[model samples]
Target: MSLDYTSHSHRPEPDELVPSRYALRIGEIDVLVISDGVLPLPTAMLAHNVDPAVRAAWLNDMFLPPDAFDWALNVVVARSGGQTILIDAGLGLDPDLNLPRAGQLVRRLEAAGIDLGSVTDVVLTHMHMDHIGGLLVDGVKDRLRPDLRIHVAAAEVEFWASPDFSHVSMPPGFPDALRSAAKRFVKEYRSQLRTFEEEHEVAPGVVVRRTGGHTPGHSVVRLASGGDRLTFAGDLVFAVGFDHPDWYNGFEHDPEESAQVRVRLLRELAANGELLVATHLPFPSIGRVALDGDVFRWVPTFWDY
Candidate 1:
C-alpha cells in the first residue's frame, strides 16, 4: 500500500516520535523504521572482555550514562508495491524477563500504517528471543499471523531447535515457560517457516545476506531500489559505544567472528556510502558508516519527520 506521509493521523504521538521511528524513501520503496522499545542493561552485563576502568573511561568519553545502557530494538518495515515485509520481530512481553518495552513492535507497526495481519513476510535475522518474540502476541497460543511467511537462516533455526543443544548449550535459568512457548510455537508453525542460505531475494528489491557471528546462522538484510541501498546489520555490529567498533557484547556466541564480520561490513558500507539500519543503535537506528582515521563511526541520518 502507498503511504501518505502527510496523514498525521497515522503518525506516532509526540512522545513516541523518537529518532528511532521514522520513514525513509529509497527510490520507489518506503522503509519505515519501527522500534521494539529499548532494553536497559546493567553495566556489568556489558563489561564483557574490557577492563572496568577502561569501560568506564570509554563510557565517560562517549558521554553515556555511567550507571547502565539503553539498547534500542529496531525492526525494519519496508513497503513497496503490494509487499509489506517485516524484518526481525521485536521482543514481546515477558514478565519473567522484566521487559516492558518489548511488545511495542506491533503498535509501532500500526503507527507506520502497517496492519500486523497484512504483513506478508517476516524475515528473521536470527531466532533469538529479541528477534523472534514479537512473532507471537502476549497470551496468544497460535502464530500471530497464521499465514505469514517466516524466513529464517537454516543453520540458525536448526541450532536453536535442535534437541541436542537444549540440555547442553542452552543458557541456564532461561525461563522455562517461555521456552515451552517457543517450542510449541515452532512446532505448530514450522511448516510456514522456510530456511535459506547465502543469498536469496525475499521480494523484488529486498535480499537476504547471511553474515554469521553473533549466532551460528545469523544474517543481515539488504534492500535496494534504484541506486539507493539499505542494509540491516543485525547483531554483527553492536551500537555499544559508536566509537568502539571492536567492542563485542559478552553474549555473542563468537566474539571474534562477530567483530571481524562487523569490521568488514562497516568497511563495505563506508565505501559504498549506503544507508544502514543498526538494531542496537540509538533510535531510528538508520545511519551511514564513515571512517575516522583507523576506526569507523555511525553517522545518523536526518529524517524529515
Candidate 2:
C-alpha cells in the first residue's frame, strides 16, 4: 500500500510520543544516538542514477512510499578521555525548504541532558548543512565551550570555498541553501576548526578518518574500545546502498567515487563484523553489515535498553 504523508501529520509537537534518542556503549566509550527528526525527501534523491521504473520497484518491495519518505536524521554523542564530542551536528531549525519535521537536534540534546557548554570537541564527517547545521543555530555557539575544537578534514573545508554543484542533482534551492550553510559555518567557526590531513584521534578511542567520495573530504568516525568497534558513516552509505551499491545519491558530489567508497567500507565492515551507525539511516541505526552474494545486507541489531 502506498503511504500518504502530510506535513501537518508529521509536524513536531511540544511532547513527542515516539522515540527520539537511543543510548548504546562501544566498550568504554559512552555513545548516544539522538534523532534530529526526519527529512521527507523525494524518492528520486535515493538513486538518481537508476531508472524510475527500477527505483519504484525497489521502493515498493521495501514497503515505502512511491513519492517521498522520511529519512532519519541521526546525530551521535560520545564521551571519552574526559572529552565530550558531538559528531555531525543535526539540521538546525527554520529551514526554508519546508522541512519543519526535522531540525530537532538541539531540543533533543537538551532533553538528553547534553549541555552544549560541556561539548569539548565536535567531529564533523563533512561540512554538509545537515551534518553541521545544528551548530549554526542561534546562540548555539555562545552556549558551546569557547575552547571547543571542531575537527574536520582539510580537504572538506577547502572544497566548500568554491563548492562544485555541477555534479549534484538536488531539489530546487537546495544547492544554494547548502552552499549558504557551509559558508556561514566556516565563516563563524573558522578559528575553532581543527583540520586534519588523513585521520586524527579526537578522544581516546574515537578517530575521524577522511574518506573522500560523497564530497572532497567526506569522513567517518571509528570508535574502538576494549575490542569493540562501531563506525559512524556520514553520507557514504544509505538504506538503498546495500542492494544498490552503485546507485548514486543525488547529494553525492562524486557519485562514481562514492560508489567506490561505499563498496570498500561495506566490505570492510562486513568482514570485521563491526556495528554501524549513520546520519540518514533509521534511528539508532545500530547494526552490522553482512555480505549477501554480490550485494550486501543490513543487519540491524536488536534494541538494547
Candidate 3:
C-alpha cells in the first residue's frame, strides 16, 4: 500500500522560536546563559569508540535519535564584583562554514541587554574553535571586545601557538586553521591578554582550574561567592558522557586522560553539591551532578519563570 504524502489543509506555519537565554543567581554573582545555537553532529562521530550495540542501546534508552546528536553551543556571562565577564566566545561570524544556524551569540547578547564594550573580561576555558570562534569578527582583524582582558590557560596558548601543534594529527586543515586563528587572536589582543599557569582567581570569585585532556590546556571555571559555587565545565562531559564517563569522543587529544578528568570531576561535583554549567549540554545547561550507582546523572536546574 502507498502512504499519503500530501500536506494537511489546517496545518499552521512553523513558529521560529527565539533562541534561549536564562539568568541564574549564584549567591552574590549573576550568570546569564546565552544561546549561540545548536550543532547537529552524527551520533557515530560522538560514540565511535563505544561498541555499536552498546551505543545503540544507550540511544534507545534515552529516546534519542540513533543516527543524530543535537549538541547545544552555550556561552556564559558572569556578573560579579561590578565586573561583567564572558566565559567563552561563541562561534563567530563565519559565513563559509556549515554552521549557518550557529554563531548567534553577539545578537543574543544584545537582546539580553549586554553591550560588548561593557564586558570587562573574556575567560577562555580552552582554545577550541567553538569556544573561541566568537572572539574575531571576520576571522582576521575585527575583534568583539578587543580591550577586554582575555584570560586563558598558559599551557593552551603555548601549545596552540607553537610549531609543535601543526604536527598534531587532525582533519586536513584543522591544525593550520587553528594555528592561524590562535595567532590572530594573540596578536590582536596581546596587550589585554593574561595567561595563568595555575589555578587562580581571574576575577573576584572567579577561579580557573586546569583540567587538561580534551585539549592540552582544557580547563573549567569555578565561581564562588557567599559560600555558593558554580563551575563552568568547558567540554568536560557531553550528554552520553554522563552515563559513561570513560566513553571518549573523537575530539579529545587524550581520551584516557579526558576520561580520568571526567570521572574525577564528576565525583567532586556530586560530592560537593556544586552547580555545573556545561557548554555542550541542552540550552540553559546549568545542572548538578548526582551519583547514580556506578555512574553519574545530570539533573538540570529547575526553570524559574
Candidate 4:
C-alpha cells in the first residue's frame, strides 16, 4: 500500500483553547510542548484491564466518560544555549488520513517563535506514527531542519525500520501510514540519525534513559543542569489519572513491560522531586510526581510559562 499523507479530520474549532505553545525555564534550558492538535480515540482502546469495573472506575475517576475518548498531542521542544531541540515531531499533512490536526506541527512551532531551521536536534522516544510522523514534510526530501542531528533509540530504529512489520495495527481510518513514515525515516534520514544505548547523554544535561515497553526502544529524557531537573516522560503515562506508577496504557506494544518501566520511572520521579512533561497528558502537559508512600501521583503545574 502507498503512504497516505492526509490531515486529521477533527481539529480544534476557532474558539477552542488549544495550547499551541508554552515554555519551562530550567536554569539555562527552555523546554516547550508545541501543540500538534488533538485526536478522537475509540473508547474501547483501553479495555485491557483485568476487570471491566476497574477500567470503568479508572475512566470515571479520571472524569472521562465511559463511551468516548479524546486526546491531544503535545510534542516537546527544548532550547538551551543557542541549540533548539525538538522531541518527537507530530503528524504532518497526509491526504488519505483525513486527520485535521496531523499537519500543524511546524505551524505550531512557528507560533511558538521557533524557526525550523534552527532546530539542532530531534529526539524520538519511539517510532509510533504520531510521534515520528512529522520527521519529514509532505514532499520535502529531508527533515524540517536538514542539518539537525536526529537521536533515536537503537532498538526503536531496528523495530520500526524492519520491513516485515509493515502491516501492524494503526488507529482507524489510517492503515499503512505509520509503517510508511518509519520506512521514510530510515531511507532518507538514516545518515543524520544517531542511535544511543540506555542512560546515554545525547547532549550536555540531556540524558536518554531506556524505558522500553511502549516499544522495544521506548525511552524518556532527563534534563538536568545547574541543580535543576525535569523529565520529558513521553508516553509513559497517558492522562492525568494514570499517575499511579503501575498504571500502563493499553496501547503499549508490551503492556507488562510498559507497566514495569512506568513503575521505575514514577518512583524515580517521585524520589528526585523532578518536574514531568508527558506527551499524551493534558495540554501544557507539565507536572511533578509526588509519592504517597509506595504509590505515585501527578501534580500538574499551574504554569509551565
Per-residue lDDT for 61-83 in model 1, tens only? 78888778788888888876677
Predicted structure with the largest TM-score when compared to the true one: 2
Q: Per-residue lDDT of 160-243 in model 2, one digit per residue for the tens? A: 999999888898988889899999999999999999999999999999999999999999999999999999999988999999
Give a tens-digit lDDT track for model 4, residues 1-305: 00011112224346556546665567666676667887667544554444667777878887898866767787877766567778888777666677785557876665545667777888888877778777667654443566678888888888775533322233553435667878877887888898887767766778778778888898888888888898888888876334444544545777677778888777778788888887778777778888776667778878622
Candidate-wise lDDT, in order: 0.73, 0.90, 0.77, 0.70
Judging by lDDT, tell me the better candidate of 2 and 4.
Answer: 2
- lDDT of model number 3: 0.77
Model 1 residue 49 lDDT? Answer: 67
lDDT of 3 by residue, 1-305 (tens): 00011111212223435546777667888888777888766676565567988988988998989887678999888887877889999877666567777888887776566777778888998887778888786632343456678888889888776635421334456566666767877787778878888786767898888888888788999999899999999888898888988887766777778889999999999999999988888887888999999999999978765
Error of 2 at 31 (Å): 0.3
Ten-residue stretch with the least lDDT total in model 1: 163-172
So what's the TM-score on candidate 1? 0.88
Best candidate, lDDT = 2
Which stretches of candidate 2 lie above 4 Å from their native place?
1-14
Worst 10 residues of 2 by lDDT: 1-10
The candidate with the higher lDDT, 2 or 3, is: 2
Prediction 4 TM-score vs. true: 0.85
Candidate 2 local Cα displacement, residue 48, angstroms: 1.1
As a TM-score, model 3 comes out at 0.88
